[model samples]
Target: MSAHVPQICVMGVSAAGKSTVGIALAETLAVPFVDADSLHLESNRTKMAAGTPLTDDDRWPWLDAVGAEYAQAGASGLVMACSALKRVYRDRIRAAAPGVVFVHLGGPRELLLERATARTDHFMPSSLLDSQLDTLEPLGDDELGVAVTVDRTPAMLVSEIIERLRA
Candidate 1:
């Protein structure tokens, strides 16, 4: 089972580099990648774009669908970029695939807000940054396999993850 490849959820609040690092990692691993934001309903996107935070109830189904897609992928692993801020959200993913590994892209909130502000036309607005940060849960020390922060370059981040997986 050393080659056991679980779906990788590149998770964190907005602007934490989930999508950036996930795509690079997917390319390096030659696996398919999913931008979890793409699965959001138009209404959810609009709400967030309007600077409204979505409740957990509103996010449950959307999260489920992303998990379902990877669960359906069989042997091939998938990398998903998402702001799975709450432990309950992570729990849902675990329920779908026990082997799913979450790579939390975490860092200083001010840095994230700055990045969010610089981005254009994104669904998540800078206004909700604090709430996103509030909802974040750091991985427990013995949780699973590799869990990393967004403090490094994309290549470095991907390299660290690949090394962890290989070990």
Candidate 2:
């Protein structure tokens, strides 16, 4: 790995195991972990809890806050889990914290749905999965990130990410 540890954003639709993998990755990298959902405005959380999807306006401030958190981490480095579902959203985050790398977690819809259904206490309900998947734009070829399949255990996923980063 480089002398400077990369600030990583674990991104995907809800239930793609971003938080699970991100926490393990942060442990491995010895960096702090933040969940963007925890930073959401109460209004956004209310809407999501009611099964309504947020518009771009609703997301801008939240994304900016997430980006700012990354910028704040600076050389200390951070691993954040966010449903950065669009290219524009990722671009917005990149604009705030340049050189941020995204780890895109992906899996089949059935698996995602199963995970979503199995979760408890999360603000994002299973009903929002389709909307999230609909909005997701896969990482571009030029994007600074790796797409990892989410069919394995969180430890294995973290190991894969660590190996890739080290290489």
Candidate 3:
């Protein structure tokens, strides 16, 4: 039988270091890394760049695209970075990839806002941080994943994630 290949989504609100931790985790696990932001339509990116929060209608297609990536990863597995702030969104991804696990990175709003404000290259604006925070639904007890506090270095965070995932 083939070895089990892990599919992981590193999720959280904006500026919670989803991309950074996802990248590090992918490297450590020897999997392909995908930043789900890259799957957003240009129109959605434009709306977010203007500091407008996306409506649920605006996000459905993008969320499906993220799910498609997970489905396409197949035996190769994948590590994805996405702001899966709502339970429905995570459920959407799970529908596409049943074996996928989530790693939720959570931190204080102040720290998230501070990090969002410091970013220069991302399309998301600090103004939308509150919206993201308001929309966040943490992982449930029955979910196949772990919620981690983002209070340490990326290396440290990745280590903790690895340990917890193995547990």
Candidate 4:
């Protein structure tokens, strides 16, 4: 691991293991971990719970909040799990925390749906998986990030992320 603590965003569609991998990665990196879903307004959560997808307007404030968290972390660094499903959203966060690096967790639709369905605690419904997937824009070549398949265990994924980030 590098001597410098990293500010990282674990991004993906719902149930793509962003939170799981993010938590482990933070622990390994000795930084704080936050799930960006916690930053959502109750109205947004209610909308998602009702199987409604959020419009861009509904997300702007929430994304700004997530970005603020990253900005607040400063040099201490932070690991955040956020469904930054679009390049614009990622850009918004980057504007706030310029050094933030995203780690995109990607997987097949079947696996994503299965995991989304299995999770009973989240507000986001499995019905919204397709919408999130539809909105997702993979990390571009110009982006400071890496894309990793989520077929492996969280430990393996975190290790890979650590290695990639280090390199």
Which 10-residue window of candidate 3 scores lowest in summed lDDT? 1-10
Ranking by lDDT: 4, 2, 3, 1
Global Cα RMSD, each model = 1.6, 0.9, 1.8, 1.1
Better of 3 and 4 by TM-score: 4
Q: How does model 2 score by TM-score? A: 0.97
Global local distance difference test of model 2? 0.93
Per-residue CA lDDT of model 3 for 17-109, tens digit only, reads 999999999999999999999999999999999989999999999999988999999889899999988889999888988888999999999
Task: Give the TM-score of each candidate.
Answer: 0.93, 0.97, 0.96, 0.97
Which candidate number would show the highest lDDT if scored against the true structure? Answer: 4
Steric clashes per prediction = 0, 0, 0, 0
Q: How far is candidate 4 from the true structure (C-alpha RMSD, Å)?
A: 1.1
As a whole number from 0 to 100, the lDDT of residue 20 in candidate 2 is: 89
lDDT, candidate 3, equals 0.92
Off by over 4 Å in 2: none
Task: Give lDDT per model, in order.
Answer: 0.83, 0.93, 0.92, 0.94
Clashing pairs in 3: none
Q: Please, what are the lDDT tens digits per residue for candidate 2 over residues 1-167? A: 46697799999999999888999999988999999999999999999999999999999999999999999999999999998999999999999998789999999999999999999978889999999999999999998888999999999999888788678
